[model samples]
Target: MKVLTETWWSAAIGREKTVTVVLPPSYSPVGGPFPVLYLLHGFGGNRNTWLQCANLSAVVDSHRLVLVLPESGRAWFINDARGRRYEDYLVHEVVDHVDAAFNTVPTRDGRAVGGFSMGGAAALYQALLHGDRFSVVASNGGAFEAPLREGDPYEALRGDRNLAIPSTRDHERVWGPAGSEVRRRYDPYSLIRNRDPRHPIEVYLDIGLDDYPRMISMNRRTRDALTAGSVPHEYRERPGGHDWDFVDAGLRDLFAFTQGHLLSA
Candidate 1:
């Protein structure tokens, strides 16, 4: 396995951002470009979070895919109301750089996105909105549902749930007001309800039994919504909490689920 960092100027976020990449053991240009998994961290984490927390390199060495972790700080991996277009920065700018410099498959069939908590939700959000860019999505202990109180923004799109924002309250700063267009745009539930079928995405999500009740309910809600929408997906429950121990325990399953779905590069 090999680890490296790549940095470049992002027009979307209008600044230079860095990402951590883990190359599979068999990595080599002559061996052909490898599939890529764009991994994300939890809230307040950076590119190094996964490595520091989990034995990521050892777990993924046999998977034969490249793992890319983006450095999105407390941004919920969405375009922030504070004028940061993290969504654009990730799907476009960072991807473009990785494809050019690294030997990656660079297409929907060979690409997938996943993450921890905030990152996990972001993975689903990015895939749901830009299905053209990825074919598989995975989340572990993900914050699928936003923490909204009574009388949040009502959904402009179809769904029983509403995500509106009245002010910049914590994550709402990144996701926008509860039901703002921006907020609705990133809501995985609403997006799944109105998913574009042309993409044919495969999804996987799991939550630890000991995780917060809100997280459990949100994951279940997401699973139910996927089932209702007839989207190809899998959901699981494990005995752990919202910590790296849980994430590390499931890395194999996550990689296998992703590997089983991605087309050969």
Candidate 2:
């Protein structure tokens, strides 16, 4: 297996965004291209989260697929109206650059995206909103619709002065606006509501039964919505909590499922 670290830059962010790309044992530029998985990191994490926190390279190399881990910081993988075009930076800039520079198969079928926590939600949003660009998506313990709920942790980071929780609106401010419509756009629950039931993308989601209570409720609601809409998906709940231990344990199952679908692509 070959691991390339911090090789690409993101022009949209105007800074050096670190990334880790892993190539399978037989990877060769002259021989052929391989399917790619864009792995996103959670809040307070960098590109190395997958490598250091979980053994993704070992898992992917065993299957002979390419994996790319991109750093999005705490931006939640969304383009803020405040001027950060992170969504553009990721789907357009990063995907285009990687396909051109590496022996990566650039097609909806050849691509898959997933993440944990905030990153998981981002992956879901990316796949849902841009279904034509991705064939598979998975979210492990993601804040699927946390952006729409009260007492969001992000509010503590925003430092906004006008919000109801002025002292704790800082994080929300950083994410920009708090209107119902804007919140709905980021909320996965709303995505399922607005989109067609037969959306082509395949989605996988699971959160520990003992994690955040609010998120647990939201995931149930999300499952209900999917069922009501007849949207096909995979959902699982197990004994764990919201932490790296639970995520690392969950990765094997999630990766196995993703590998099967992504390889078929």
Candidate 3:
């Protein structure tokens, strides 16, 4: 696989953004376009997160596909009410820029998105909100449920001064104050409930059973919501935790699913 690190100005956030693109050995800008997979990073992570943690390079090389990993900081991959339009930046600017600069398929049928943790939630939100832009979406150890229900372990973490919740400020800025209508609109449960069942997007969700209690609960709740809505999806609970080990364990299956869908699309 060939890896390219690039930086370019982004009008969406009023600053330059960085991204890492991985191309298969067979890729040639003059030969043909290939399907693209957008791999997102979680809170406190950057564009190289997936490349460094997951064994995705082998997957790309073997499948002869392309991978695009973009840095969005802790933006939650959402358009914040505080003036940062990260969702727009990702769906429009980054997608357009990658397609323009490389031999990408340049259509929803040729695209897939997946991530873990904060990025996992963002991947689901993006696919649900913009089904026309992706053929498949996967989330591993995703933070799907919102509003931090009573008894949620995260609630206690929120109040603990000793713990560092990196997403605190960005969550508020992106979704507005907790319990607001804006938050509801971006919640994965709400999005799934409101989505049209006729939309043709394949969904995959998995969470490590030993992950944060709140995260596991939220992922199960998301699966329940999808089941209740009759949204076609694949859900799994594996014996692991919220770390690279779990993600690496599932990367092969995730990539296989994505590759199957993209090829059939």
Instruction: Compose the digit string of candidate 1's lDDT tens values, residues 73-132.
Output: 766667767778888888988888889988888799999999988889889989998999
Clashes of 3: 0
Q: Compare the candidates by lDDT and give the number of the best one.
A: 1
**TM-score, ranked from best to worst:** 1, 3, 2
RMSD of each: 5.9, 4.6, 2.7
What TM-score, to 2 decimals, does candidate 2 have? 0.86
Residue 126's lDDT within candidate 2 is 85
lDDT of 1: 0.82
For candidate 1, the 10 contiguous residues with the lowest summed lDDT are 157-166
Error of 1 at 168 (Å): 7.1
| Stronger candidate by lDDT (2 vs 3) | 3
By summed lDDT, the worst window of 10 consecutive residues in model 2 runs over: 161-170
Alpha-carbon lDDT, every model:
0.82, 0.73, 0.79
* Model 1 CA RMSD to the hidden true structure, in angstroms: 5.9
- Candidate 2 lDDT over 64-141, as tens digits, reads 577888886656678764567778888988788788878777888788899888778788888878876777888888
Q: List the residue pairs that clash in candidate 2.
A: 157-170, 157-171, 158-170, 158-171, 159-169, 159-170, 159-171, 160-169, 160-170
lDDT of 2 at 21: 83
